[model samples]
Target: MSAALRADPLADDTIAAILAGYGGSQWEAIALVNRLLAQWQSNADVQGWQAPDGTPAPIAAALQAYLAAAATLPAWADAARIERAEELFFDMSMLSCSLLFCASLPECYVVPDLAGVLHVAGQLEAHCDYRVRSTAAMIFPVMMKGGLASPQGGGIAQILKVRLIHATIRHLIVRGNPAQAAGAAVPALDAPCRHLYDTLYNHGWDVPANGLPCNQEELAYTLLTFHYIFLRGLRRLGLGLAPQDEEAYLHAWNVVGHVLGIEDGLLTHDMAQAEASFAALQARGRQSPFLPDPRPALGAALMRAMQDQIPLRLLKPFPVLLTRYLCGDAARIDLALDQRVNLLSRALFGAGMGLARAIDSVVRLALPGFSICRMMTRIVGYQFTVKFLMNQTRPLKLPPALLNQVGHTVRAWGDDPKAPRWMNALEARLAGRKARRAAPGGQPC
Candidate 1:
C-alpha cells in the first residue's frame, strides 16, 4: 500500500468537522455570487451594449474585493512553475479538451451522487449541449496566460461562478423531489464505513435549514477529476511532460483548488501524490451500492455536437472513436454510446492514431520547440469553439435555468429575452459613467 494510505488519514469525524467549517463559507460565497449576477444584469441594463468592465461603482467594487480576498495564491505557489504549466497547457489544448470532455466527463458519471445531481437537475436532459459549452467557456479563460490571478481574466471569476453553481445544485437536489434524490442515493452501508461512504457516494450529511448542500470532500473529489484525471489522460496518450512541468501543472491547479475552497490536504502537488489519492478515491467509489445510470444521455449528445465541428465526414466518427479509445470499452458502455464501430473501423482508427503519434514523434525529434501536436490542437480547438458558440442563436453561457432553478433570480443569460435591452442600456450607462468621471468630479455620481 502507498504510504499515504498507510498513514491513517484523518478519521471520518475529523473530515466531517472540516467540511462543516467550510460549508458555511461556501454558502456565503454563493449568496455573494447571487448578488453579483443581479448587479451584472442591472449594470448591463444601464450600460447598454458594451460589456461591463467589472467596474462601475459598488457592484464592481464588491466583486473586485471578493476576488481579491479569494484569489490569493497559496504559500506554496511558484510563479515560474505556473508560467511553464500555462505554456504546456496551450501547447496541448486540443488533447486537454478532449480528455476533459470524453474521458473525464464520462468518468464523472461513474460517481453515483454526481450523476444523480446532474440528472435530477436536468443538466443532462435536453440542454446537455449548453451545459457542455458553458463548462468549456468557464475553463478556457482560466487556462490562458494571466488568467487565474488577473482580475481582467476569467480564471478566478469563472471558477467562483462554478462554485456558486455547485451550491445551487446542492440546494436544488436537497429541496427538490425526495423520490428523485433518493433514487440517486447509493445503497446503505455499515456505520463506521458510512461516513466515508457518504463522503464519497452521497453528497453529505443532511443539514438543518441553514446548512449547505455539498461538503468539502465532494468538492475535493471534483478538483481531483480535473487535475489528476486530465494529467493521467495525457500520459495515456503517450504525451509525456518533463517531471518539473508535470509538477508545475499540478501546482497551478492546486492554487485553483485552494481558491475554490478545497482543503490543502486534498490538494496534490506531484504525480505520486495524485496517483495515490486517485486510487483511494476510485476504491471508495467502487464500494457504492449503485452503478451509475447508463452513461447520462448527455454524453451521447455531446459526441453528436462535436461531430458538427469537424468538417470532414471521415473525421466525423473520429471524435466518438477517440472518446472510446481514451475512455476504453467500459466507459463507452457505461456512457451508453449508441454508435458501434466494426473491427475494421476500429483497426483503421488505431492505425491512424499510431501514424499521427509517429509523425508527431519525428517532428519533435527534428525540432523540439515546434510541435505539430500543438498546431493540430489549435486548429481543432478553434473549430470546436466556433461551432459550439454558434450552436445557439445567442452565444451560449452557463448556470442555465435547469441548474439554477432553485435560485430563481439566477437565469441563463444566453436565453434571456431581456439580453438585448440590457446590453443596449449597458453601453449607454458605461458611456455616461466615463463622461461623468472625465468631467471635473473625479468620479461619477
Candidate 2:
C-alpha cells in the first residue's frame, strides 16, 4: 500500500512516454483531451479510437500501441464469473443505484485526500452536474448489458476513457512545472479555472506529500468503493448476496481494477481480505489527512446536492441520515454527516432499518424472498431514479440516443422481479409512480 501511494501506471505507460515528448504544452494536451472526450462521450462502442491517433500528432504509432493494449480485457478475466456478476447487477439494479447514492458515493469521500482532489475538481455542491456525470459515467457503462466483455459494449470503453482521464489530470497537474514530473513534492493552488485540468493542476497537490494526483493506492481504493463498499452496503441493508455471488462480484471488479492499472496485490479475493485491506488503506488516509480538511466541504456539498433533488419535504433530510447509516460513525464524522437530523426522520430511519430487518428475518422463512428491506430500498431508489437520473432537463454532453437508452433502462428498474405484486404496488405508490417507462431522452443520472 505504501508503495502504491507513490506509483502511477502512467509512469511506465507508452501514452505517458508520448505525452512526455509534448513538453507540457496545454494546446497539445487540450487537443488530445478533446479528441479522446469526443470518443468517450459518444453514444457507444467508442472506448478506443478504431482509427489511429492521427490528429497530426507525431507519436501516432505510440498512441496506437497504447490504445490497442489499454482497451483490451485482461487474460485473467473470467467470462462466466463476470456474466454472473452482471446478472446479479441486473437483479439488484435499483438497490444498486440506491447504494451508489447513499453508500458508494459517501464511502468515496471518506478518504480525505481523495475527497480533496474531488472537491477541487468538481466543487460538487455548487455544481451538481459533476456528481451526476461522474456517477453516470461509471455505473451505467460498466453495469449495462455486455458492457465489459463485448467489444461493442460501453463498459470497457468508459473505463478505458476514465483511465485516460486520470492520466490526463496527472499530466495537467504538473503541466508547467517539470519538477513535478518525477512525482517530487510540490504544490500549485493558483491556476485559473479556464479548464478542468488546469483547475485541478492549480489546486495545489504536494505530490510527495499527498502522493500523485490519482496514485495506485487511491485508484485501488476507489475501485473498492464501487465493489467492496457496495457489497458491504448490501450486507448492511440485509440484502447480502450469496457467498458465491459475492465472490463473483469481487472478481468482476478485480478485473476492472486490472484495467484501471491497479496492482494485482491491491485487489482482494474474499470479504475478510477486502475488509482488512479497505480498513488499512482508509486508516492510512485518515492518518494522513489533507490540510484544510477537504472531506467536510465535499461531504456537505454531496448531501446538499442529494437533498436538493429529493422533492419530498419529509424525505429531504433522509440523504444525510442515509449517508450516515451506510457509511457508519467514523465515516459519518469524516464526511461531517454527524449532525443530528429531525426526530421524525430519526424515528422513521430507525424503524425503516431496524424493524424492517427484524420483520424480514421472520418473514423470509415463510415466504422465500420477502424482504421489507428490499421494498423500502426499492422505494427510495425509485425516488432517486426519477429525481436524478431520468430528469431530461439536466444538460449532458451524451448523445440523445444514449440518453434515451439510459432513461429506458432506469424505467425498467421500477419493477422488482422477486417482489410480489403488492410489494411492487406499494413501492410505486410510495415513489409516486406506477411501473411504466419514463419519457425517453432523459439525462443519465
For each candidate in turn, the TM-score is: 0.64, 0.90
* Candidate 1 overall lDDT versus native: 0.52
Per-residue accuracy of model 1 over 1-445 as CA lDDT, tens digit each: 2111111112122222323333355334334446555432211122222225633344344444444445456777777887777777665644566677666666666555455455544446556675676666655655666656554444665565565455455433343322224223333334342322233233432332112234454556666777777877677666667788888888888887776666687778888988888666655644442333524476776777777777766656766777776666765765677476666657767886677577767866654543333333334444554445434555545334221221221111111121223332343242222211132432221
Candidate 1 least-lDDT 10 residues? 409-418
Candidate 2 similarity to native, TM-score = 0.90
CA lDDT of every candidate: 0.52, 0.72
Q: Best lDDT goes to which candidate?
A: 2
* lDDT digits (tens) for residues 1-445 of candidate 2: 3653444554235445556555557557457645654555432445445544345463454555566667667788889999999888888877887888888888888887787767766676577557766767667767766768876456766676677667666666655322235556556665467866567667666766777667778888888988999899999988898889999999998988887778887899888899998998899888777888877777787788778767778778888887778889998888888887889978888887899999988988877578888888777776666777666676334545555656667767776777766677677877788654334543212
Candidate 2, superposed: residue stretches over 4 Å from native: 10-25, 40-54, 176-183, 189-191, 395-404, 436-445
- Residue-level error in angstroms, candidate 1, position 341: 1.1
| Candidates in order: C-alpha RMSD to true structure | 14.4, 4.6
Provide the lDDT at 415 for model 2: 68
